[model samples]
Target: MTDILIRNIDDDDLRHIDALAAELGISRSELLRRETKDLARRHALQQVTLDDIRRSVDLAQGVLDEDLMKQAWG
Candidate 1:
């Protein structure tokens, strides 16, 4: 496996990372690895386009009425 080195992290952020790692009963490296994987997965999932939105709307076959908008806002 490839290793990663992050430099110049703030002391406070390092403390925060340690705290989170402690909370989850894992080492700081493991916490960072898990978080980095989740971040990459979410970034990959966010690749949407106008055509994708149009296709989703077409598949839904639903209208965006005021009631639906109000519910969404709430």
Candidate 2:
């Protein structure tokens, strides 16, 4: 794998990462890798949810507006 450098990390953030790494019994780099993967996965899931919402909105657009209002008020 290629090496990536992350710069400008705050001291407090670094300390937090270090603490988590110690707690997890892993190196800081390993902890960072795991966290990054988790973040990416969550982001992908959110995108999928947003896409589903968009599709629902688009489908609703074709439905009768009066029906929607009646449903909303009822």
Candidate 3:
């Protein structure tokens, strides 16, 4: 694991973060770590979902005639 140093956070923001960490019974570092991991996981899942959708669209292209598509959509 690598260390990250964030500089110049506002005092009020730091206090709020500390309070939240305390509420969750975790250290501030642990709270930040968990949130960062969760954000990355969600982003990866979204990318996978988008790729699947694009693949499906590619596979479906030209399978339907234009007239049929228009009628189905309308």
Output candidate 3 Cα RMSD.
4.5
Clashing residue pairs in all predictions, respectively, total: 0, 0, 0
Model 3's TM-score against the true structure: 0.63
Candidate 1, after superposition: displacement of residue 58 in Å?
A: 3.4
Model 3 agreement with the true structure over 1-74: per-residue lDDT tens digits: 99999999999999999999999999999999998999999997776577798999998986678987887688
TM-score of each model, paired residue for residue? 0.70, 0.62, 0.63
* CA-lDDT, candidates in order: 0.91, 0.88, 0.91
Models, CA RMSD each: 5.5, 4.7, 4.5
Residues 1-74 of candidate 1: C-alpha lDDT, one tens digit per residue: 89989899999999999999999999999999999999999998899999999999897753557787677688
Task: Compute the lDDT for candidate 3.
Answer: 0.91
Better of 2 and 3 by TM-score: 3
* Candidate number with the higher TM-score (1 or 3): 1
Given candidate 3, what's the lDDT at residue 71? Answer: 79
Q: Which candidate gets the maximum TM-score versus the true structure?
A: 1
lDDT-sorted candidate list, best first = 1, 3, 2
